[model samples]
Target: MSLRTVARDDLKNAARSYVVLGVVGVFAALVALVFVSERNIYPDPYRTLFDVSFMTFLVFPLFVAPLSYLAVAGDRESGVVKYVLGLPNSRLSYVLGKFASRASVTLGAVVVALLVGFVVALATFENAPNLGRFATFAGVSALYGVSLTGLFVGVSAATRRRSRAMLGVFGAYFLLVPFWFGFLPIVNIGTVLDAVATTFGTTVTESTRSFVNALSPATAYLYATEPVYSGVTDQYPQLAGTFGGESSRIEAQLWFNVLTMAAWGALGLLAGYASFRRSELG
Candidate 1:
C-alpha cells in the first residue's frame, strides 16, 4: 500500500470515530452561538466575522489536539503498526498518509463550522454575509488548523505510548494557547514577563513582544488574517504588528505571519518524520 491507500483507510477510520464527531459538532455549535448572540451587538458583517474567527482561533487547538494526538501512537500501542508496516507501506508513507488524512479531517471540520456560521448569519442578520470576506476567513482558518494538526501528528508519530502522546499534545495546547498569554498566572510567560518588567522597571519592546506572540500558531493565524479586517473594522486587534506599515521590523510584515504558519507545519512534519524513521516498530 502507498500513501494514498493509507490516507484513504485512515480517513475512513476517522469518519467512524465518535470523538471526531463530537469535536466537529462542538466547533460548529460554538460558531453558530457566536453568530446568533453577537449578530445584534455587532451588526457589521466584518465585525461579526472577526468575532467568530477570534473565537475559532482560541478554541482551535482544543478541537485539533484530540483528532491528531493519537494518529500513530494509538496504532503503535494497539500493535496495528506492525501489521501495517508488514505491507508495502514505508514509514515515510505511513507518516505522510496520517498527516494527509488528519489534515483533511481538520479542514473538513473548518468548512462545516464556517458553513454553519454563514447559514446562521444569512438567517438572523439583515445583510447577507460578505462572501469574499467569509471565504478569506475560512481559508486562513483552514491553514491554521492544518498547521496545528501537523504539530500534533508529529507528536503522535514520535511517541510510542498513547498517554505520552496525549500529555505531549495537550501540554503543548495549554502552553501555546492559554498559558502563553497569562490566562494561567503561575505558568504564563506573558504574566511572568509583565511581573519582571514591573519590578525592574525594564520595558519589553513592542517588536520583541510581537515576535514572542508570533511564535504561537494561534497568534500567527491571527496575524495572517489581519488584512481581512484592515478597512472593515478596528475590532480586530493586531497580534504581530501593523501589516504593510512603515515599520522595518520583519515581524511587522504580513509575509512574516504567513511564513510563520507555513514553517510550523513544515518543521513539525520534518521533525516527526525524522523521529518516526528512527523508531523501532518491533
Candidate 2:
C-alpha cells in the first residue's frame, strides 16, 4: 500500500484504542466537573477556570505517552511490525505514519475535552473565555499533544523491545522532563549566569532566567496556555478576586513556548527515525 493509504489504516487502528477512549472520557468528565463546580463552589469563575487549565500539564503526558508507546512497541512485541515491513513499507514511513495517526488521536481528544469545558463554562457563568484565548488554548493545546506524541513514539521506535521502550519513555516523562524544573531551583542558576557573564561579559535578567527555566515541555505548555482573563471584575462583579491576581503565570512568549514544544517533538522524531532505521527485529 502507498504511504498515505498505510497511514489512513493506521489512523483507523489508532482510533480504536480503548486507552485513547478512556483518557478522552476522563478528560471530558474532569473538564465538565470543573465547570459544574464553577457554578456552585468557586465564586470566581475566571480564576477557577485558570486553575483548571493547569490540568492540561498533567493530561498532555498522560494521554500521549501511552498512545505513542503502544503504537510501535506493542506491535514490535507482537511481531506485527515484521508483517508490516513485509508489505513494502520503509521504517521511516512506519514511524511517520504512526506519528500522524497517534498524534491526530491525541489532538482530537484535547479538542473534544476543551469543547466540553467551553460549553459548560458558558452555561455556568453566563460568560465564556475570550474568543482569542479559547482559540489559542485549543490550538496550542493540540500542538502540545502532538509534540508529546512525537517524542514518545520516537522513543518507542528507538527500540524493538517493548520493555526497553517503556522504560525509556517512562524515564523521559517522569524523570527527565521534571529534572529541569527541580535542577534549576537547586543548582543556583544565578551562579551559572555569573560564570556566563564573567566569560562572555553578558548579563542575564530575572526575566531571562524565567524564560530559560521554561525549557522543559511541561513548563513550556503551562506558560503558553495560561488564560489571560482581563476585565473579569468588570464583567462578573462577584469574581473580582480573579482580577489582578498573580499566580501560575510564566515568563515566556507564545512563540517561545511553541518552539520549545516543537523542538522536543523534532528531536524525538529525529532520534527515533535514526535509531529505528538501524533497529533489528527480534
Candidate 3:
C-alpha cells in the first residue's frame, strides 16, 4: 500500500476509537462552564477562562496517555503495523502520519475550548482581554499539549505494548514533570529571598530579585493566576497584575510563560519523535 493510502486508513481507524470522544468531552465541559459562569463577577472573562485552561495541563495528559498507547500497540496486537510496514512506505512517513493525526485531534480540542472560552469571556465580561497575548498563550499551550501528548503517543508506539505505554506516560507525568519544573528549580535560594522581600518590608535583595526572574515553569504555572484587575467588570482575579505584573503597567502579557511553554513543548516533541525513530518495529 502507498504511504498516503495507509495513512488515510489508519486515521480512519483512530477516529472510531475513544480519542475523538475524549476531546469532545473536554470541549463540551469548557463550554458548559462558560454558560454557568455567566453570573460570575469576573472583570476579564478571558483571564478567568485562561485560568480554567490550566485544566488542560491535567486533562491532556490523561487523554493522550492511553490513546497514544493504542496507536501502536493495537496495530501490533492485530498484526497490522507489521503488515503495513511491508508496504513501500518509509518508516518516517508512517510515524509522522500517526503523530500528526493523533496530535491534530488533541490540538483540535484545545483550540475549540479556548475559542469558546474567549467568546464567553467577551460576552460575559463586557471587555476583551489582550487578544494578541491571549492568542499567544493559546497557541503555545496548544503546541505544548500536542508535543506532550504526542510524546506519550510515541512511547506507546515504540513499546508496542499497551501496558508499558500507559505506565510510561503516567510515570512521566508524575515523575518527570515534577523533576523538571519542581526540584530542578527549587534549589534557587534566591527565589526564597525574593519572595520574602515581596511579602515583607525588607531590603530588596538582588539575589532574591535574581531568583524572581529565573523562576521555573512549574513554579510560574503555580502562580499563573490572572492578576485580579480590580474594577474591571466580569474579570477573574479582578487585579491589575494579570498580564506581566506591575512591570510598568504591561498587565496580562504572558510572553515569558508562553515562551517557556513553547520550549518544553518542543523538547517533548523532539524527545518523543526521536525515541520513536530509534525503535525497531516488531
Q: Whose lDDT is greatest here?
A: 1
TM-score of 3: 0.67
lDDT tens string, model 1, 105-170? 999999999899989888888778888878888998999999999989998999999999999899
Residue 8 lDDT, candidate 3, scale 0-100: 76
lDDT of each: 0.84, 0.74, 0.58
Give the TM-score of each candidate: 0.90, 0.80, 0.67
List the lowest-lDDT window of 10 residues for candidate 1: 233-242
List ranges where model 3 is wrong by over 4 Å.
Answer: 1-7, 128-134, 176-280
The residue pairs that clash in candidate 1, if any, are none
lDDT score of residue 79 within candidate 1: 96
**Per-residue CA lDDT of candidate 3, range 54-132, in tens?**
5555455566566565666667667877877787776666766676677767676677766776666666665565676
Which residue pairs of candidate 2 clash?
none
lDDT of 2: 0.74
**What lDDT is obtained when candidate 3 is compared to the true structure?**
0.58
